[model samples]
Target: MLKLIESLIRYEIRQNVIKERDYVYVRNQLFNLLRIEPTDQDISYESIGYPSDALDPILDILEEQHILDGSKVARDLFDAKIMNVFAKLPSEIEDLFFNLYKKDSKLATDWYYNYMKALNYIRSERIEKNEFFKTSSIYGDVEITINLSKPEKDPKSILAASKVKSLAYPKCVLCAESEGFAGNPSRDSRDQHRLIELNVNNEPWYLQYSPYTYYNEHAIVLSKEHRPMKINQKTFENLLELCEQFNHYLFGSNADLPIVGGSILSHDHYQGGNYVFPIEKAKTLDSWKKDGITYNLKKWPLSTLVIKSKSKEALIKKAVSILDKWKNYDNADLDIKSYSDDTPHHTITPIARIEDGFYTLTLILRDNQTSDEHPLGIFHPHADKWHIKKENIGLIEAMGLAILPARLKTEMAFVKSYLLTQKQLPDEALKHKDFAQKILNEHQIDKDNVDEILEQAIGEVFVSILEDSGCFKQNKEGISAFKSFIKDELI
Candidate 1:
C-alpha cells in the first residue's frame, strides 16, 4: 500500500500535475484518506506509466481491508476522492485553460484532455477495453463500439440507490452545480470534476468532456441553467458560434423531442468533438444555391441537408426558415405528420463544423409519431431491429456511429459460440437467436470467417436503423417526395 501511494505521487510529478515540493503534503492527504500513519522507513518507488497502474492495486487493498465496499460504484467514488487531492482547484484549472488558450487553442485542449485523463476523470484504462471497429456500408463507413467502459451496476448498489431519497440540489447531471460534488448513492462522484466556462450567443455556457467518450475529445457544451432543451433560431446561432470558437471541432445537437432526443433533455447541451463522423464523409447528390447560402442533399440513408455559407448570419437564417417549415410540414401519403392532435412531432438533429473556411451545418429531419402497426414510432427502429439496438437514434448514431449496449459483449460471444458449435444458446442470449439465424441464412459461416461476417451484419443492421430514422426514405417514391419539398422551397 505504501509503495502504491509513493508511486502515485511520483506519477503525478512526472505528469507535471504536482511538484516535488508538494509531494509530502499530498502524501499526507492520501495517508489520512486511507487512515494510515506515516512511515519513517524510506521506500524507493518505481514510476507508473498510467494512473490505474497504482490506483487499481491501491483500490484492491482498500477493498480487502474493508475500507471500501466491493462495488464498482464505491471504488469509483473513492478513487475520485483520492485523485481530487492532486487536482487543481476549479479556479486554478480555469485560469490554466484560458492562459494556454491564449497561446494556442489546440494546445489548450490537448493539455486539458490529458489533464482530465491523468486525474482518472475520463477512465482511460477501462475505455481502452471497449471493442471499437469500422465496417463498410453503402453509405460510407460506419463506426461501432461495444461499450464496455461503463461498469454494470451490481444488484446491491441498485437496491441501495433505490432506497436512498433523491435530492434536488444539483437538479440534474448537466447542471453547473455538479462541479466538485462529493456525490451520493443516486449520483456519480464529481470530486475530481471541473468545468471550463464559455460564452455562446452572449449567454454563459460550460464545457466538459464526456466521461464515456464516444469519439476522440468527445465534449459537452451545456447551458449553465437547469432548463429544458428547446431548438429554435437561437440553437442554430449558438451552434454556429461554438463552431467558430472551436473551428477545428464539430458541434451538434440531438432532436428536442421524445423518441429522437438524447437521454438528457431536461438540460440544454450540444455535443462536439475532434472526430469526423461517416455522415460528414458522405457524398452530396444534388446542390442548389439560394439567398447567399448553398444547400446540398446528401446521398446517405437519412434525410440530411448540408448547408454552407461564409456568412454565419445567412446560414442561420435559412436553417431556421427550414426548421420552421418542417415544424408544420405534413405529407399524408408518407405518414409524415407535423403533429397528431395537439402534440407536434417534427424536429431536427443539427450538426455544425467548419469546412474549407466556410461555416457548414448538417440538418437531419426527424419525426416521432406512432402508429398502430408500430407502437414505438413509424420512423424508429421497428420491432425486427430492436434485438440489436432499440434505443433512440440520437445525434451520435445519426452520424453513423453505433453505441451498442454492454449486453452485446456477452451476448455476441454466446452467439459466436452457438454459430461455431451448433449448440443451444442460453436463455439470456435468446434475444439474438433470430438475428443469428438471419446471418446464417445470408452467409456461410466457419470458424475463420464468422467474426468478420457477424460484424458486417451488425453494421448492415445499423444502416437500416438509420434509414428507419429518415423522415424521407431513399426509394423512388420517397425521393420524389423529398425532391418535391426541396423544389417547393426553391420556388
Candidate 2:
C-alpha cells in the first residue's frame, strides 16, 4: 500500500489538489476523502477542510470508476491511508521541496532542477562530459549538443545474461519502480535519481530532471500508472494547468506515433523545464486575429503558428479546435494526408507557456508519409542532410536545439581536418565521404577560418533539416496553404 500512497500523493500534486510537502494537511484531508474519520487522539487533522470536493479523475470521466470493493464511493480518494505507518520509506528529499515552496512557490521546481544538475545526477549515467557546439542562424543561434548517453552493455555482462533470469521487475526505466530499486544488468543506473511531484488535469503525473538534458533545467513529466502516451483535449487542459503552476517553465508533449514523435512513445509523458526555445523567440508575423486570439506565423522552417491570448480557457479551446482540423486536415497538393489505411498520418505537437498575463501556444503540424526515396518519412530529414542528423526531429529539435548522435564527436573532427588540408577523404570515412565535396562546393575554405566556416555550415544544415520536417514546404505553395488554413481559422 506504500506504493499506493506514493502513487496517490503524486496524483494529488499533479491534480493540483495539494502542494507537495503538506503531509499533515494531506493526511487530514485523506481522513475526509477516504471517509475514514481519524480517532480523537489523531490531533493532526480536523482543523482545515481540504479534500473539499476535488474534481473527479480521468478514470471516472471515462465512466470507469473502480469501486468494486463493497460499492464504496471513493470521492476521488486514494487506496492507501497517509497515516498508516508500518515502516514505509519516508519521502525522498521531499522535505526540501516543502520548505522551498513555503519561502517561494516556484523555488521547489527551480531548486530541484538546479540541484539535479549540480549533483551531476542529470548526466550521471549517460553523458561522460557535456559537449556542445553552436552556430548562428537566421532565426537565431542554433546549438547542437552531442549526446553520448546511450547505455553500453559490458562484454562480460552480455555473456552472463544467458545464465541469469531476465526480469521485467520495474517494467521500464521511467517507471517509479526505479525510484529506490537496485540496479541490474538490463536497467539503467538510478542510484542518484529523484522525481518532483506535479499534477496535470486531476491526474497523477511526475516531474523529474532529465539526465539527458539538452537544455537548461530540462525535465520529463511522466504518468503515475504505466500507460501509452495519448493526445486529447485533456492533454491541452493539463499543459495549461501545469503552465499555471510552473509559470516560468515551458511544457510540451511529443506526437504519440513514431517518426513524427519522441523516442519514448510507450510511456505517457511530457517534456518540460525552465528553458526557452528558439521558436519561442521568433516574432509573430503575417498574423490572423479572431476572438482576440492572435495567430501569428513563426519564422522557423517548420510549419508553426503561435496563438496568444489572455483567456486560458479561450486559448485551450482554440488549440483543441485547431488540433481537430489538423488531424482530419487533408491537403493533397501539399502532400498532407491525414489517414491512409487505419493509421493517422497527421498530428500536432503543442507547446504551452504563460507570459505577461497572456497564454501562448505554439502548434507544430506533423505528417508521417514514407516514400521509396525517403523511406523514413517524406517529412523527416532528407538524404543530403542525413550526414549530420539522421534521427527524428522531435519536441527538442522542434524547439530549435538539435541533439546529434555520439558518432558526430569523431566524425566532425575528421571533417574538420579535411577542411584544413585539401586532402582526399580517407577510406574509413565512408559515411561523410560524398558530403565533403558538397561542403567544398558551398564554401571556399582555408585553414585560418575553416573551423568557423564548418560551424556555420552545421547550423545551416540544422535549419535545412528542420525545414524538411515542415509539413508544408516553406516556399510559395506551402505558405499559401498555411495562410489559407489560418485564414479559415479551423479551430
Candidate 3:
C-alpha cells in the first residue's frame, strides 16, 4: 500500500512538477493512497521485507537532483519541490490533509511542512543557520533560538510594496484573496500556494504552514474573514478547537496591540506547530484556586499565568474572566496602566497546550502603555537592548526564542575580527562599534577565546531582551510588585 502511494505521488508529481501544477484532477490518487480506501490495483507494500513508507524510489529521484544533501540548502529546495507537488496537485486537498490526520497525523503534518518549505516560502538557509543557546535566567534554564533566518528586504521591493495602490486583491497576504494571486513587483506568485479549509466548532477557518518555519512544522491558522486580531473567549475557544484537531501541535497568538503584537495585526490568526519552547518547560511558581480552576504563575520573567484544568469550559471561562479583569485592573505604583485616556491598553498573549486529557492555557499579561521617556511601550525593549533586537517581542520571542535580525551575523563577524586582531572595521561595523567596544572592554576578548565569548555574549543579550519584554522585572523589587498585584487584585 505504501509503495503504491509513493508511486502515485511520483506519477502525480511528474504530471505537474514542471507546468502549471494545479488542475481539477491533480490529486486523483489521494484517496486511493489511504490503505483503508480503494486503489487502482489490489496490491500492498508487503513482499514482507519492503519499507512501509515506500518512498525510497521517489527519494532516489530526489537524490539525483541533489535535494537530499542535508547540510546545505539544496536538500531543502528538493523538499520544496516535493511540497510544491503536494500543494499544487491534491484533489479535495483540504480534506486530504484531514484524512492524513485520521490516518497518521505526524506523517500529514511532516508532509505539510515539507510542502511549505518547497515553495521557498520558508527559506531553508535561514533555518539552517539558527544558533541555539541554553542560558540560565530567573525563568530557569531557558533555551533561545537566535533567528538568522530572514534576509533584508530589497529597497526597490520595499518601495514597490509600499505603493500598493489597490486592495482589490489580498487586503494583505493573510487574506483569502491571495489564494491564486499572480506575481507583481510587490507580490510573489501564489499559484502553488495552498490552504486547507477546516471547521472549528462549525466556524470555518483555514490552515497553512509558514514558509519560513522558525521551528518544526511551524503553521499559521488564519480566520476565514480578514479581521483585526481580538483576544477573547472566542480566541481561546478557537485555539482549543485546533488543539483538538491537531493535538500533536500547540497553538499561540501574539497580543492584539503594537510593541508586543505580531507584525500582522490586520488579520486575525494564530501560530501553531510542533516546535517546543522553554516556556513549555516552565514550572508553576504560584497558584490559586477559583471556581475549581487553578491559575498558576510561571516563574519566568514574563508575567505568564498558567491555567490548568481538565474541563475545557472551566479553562475557557476562567481565562476570559481574568482577561476581562486584567484589562481594567492596574496599579499606579507598579507603573502598569490599563489604558491611556480613552484608548484601551491591556491584552494577553495566549497559548494552548493539551496533554493527559487536560488543557493548559498559558496567558502572558501584556500592557502596551507608552511613556514620554519610553516612546515605545514602557515594557518594550529599551534603547540599551535595541542593539540586539529592536522589533516587537511577539508571541514567539516572549516564549523564550529570539528571532534576531539577519544583519547580526555579519555585524557579529565584524565585531569578532576587530576584537581578535583590531582589524579595520567595515562601514556596517562602525554602527555596532559602541556595542562591540563595551563587550571588548568587559571581556578583553583575545583570539584564543573570542569565538566562545562572543557566542555567549549574544545569548546573554537574548536573556536581557526577554527580561525587557517582561512586564514584571526579574529583580526582587519587581517580584514584590508582581506578588502585590496578585494579593491585591487577582486573588
Indicate the worst ten consecutive residues by lDDT in candidate 2.
Answer: 45-54
The sequence of per-residue lDDT tens digits that candidate 2 reaches over residues 1-491 is 22233344454444333466664565556546444555434232122111211122322332343331211122111211222211123264577776887777578887676555433345433454546677877777777777777434456445544455676767777887666454544444555466766667778888787767777778788888888887778788888888887887899989877898998887888888888878888765488688979888877788898999999889888888888888888887877888988888888888989889989888998988898989999999998888888889899899888888777778878887887786765665557766766788888888887878877777788999998899977788888888888776573
lDDT of 2: 0.70
Best by lDDT: 1
Which scores greater on lDDT, model 1 or model 2? 1
Off by over 4 Å in 1: none
Which candidate comes out best when scored by TM-score?
Answer: 1
lDDT of each: 0.89, 0.70, 0.71
1-491, model 3: which lDDT tens digit per residue?
34544444444344333233442233343342221354345333323112212334545554565545322232332333333445544345565567777888777787666655544455565567777667665566656566666444466456656776655577788876676555454555554577877888777788887756777788899988989999999999999989988889999999998878999999999999997788888877677876667777778778887888889998898788879888897778778888888887889999998988889899998888888988987888877777777889899888887787777777888989988887788997787677777778888677888877787677677778777777777678777777676656655
Candidate 2 accuracy as TM-score? 0.78
Which is the winner by TM-score between candidate 1 and candidate 3?
1
Q: Which regions in candidate 2 have their CA more than 4 angstroms from the true location?
A: 1-92, 118-120, 124-128, 149-154, 157-165, 489-491
In angstroms, give how far residue 488 of model 3 lies from its true place: 4.4
Candidate 1 lDDT tens digits, 365-431: 9999998998888889988898789999999999999999999988999999988887999999998
What are the per-model C-alpha RMSD values against the true structure?
A: 1.2, 14.1, 8.5
User: At residue 201, what lDDT does model 3 achieve?
Assistant: 77
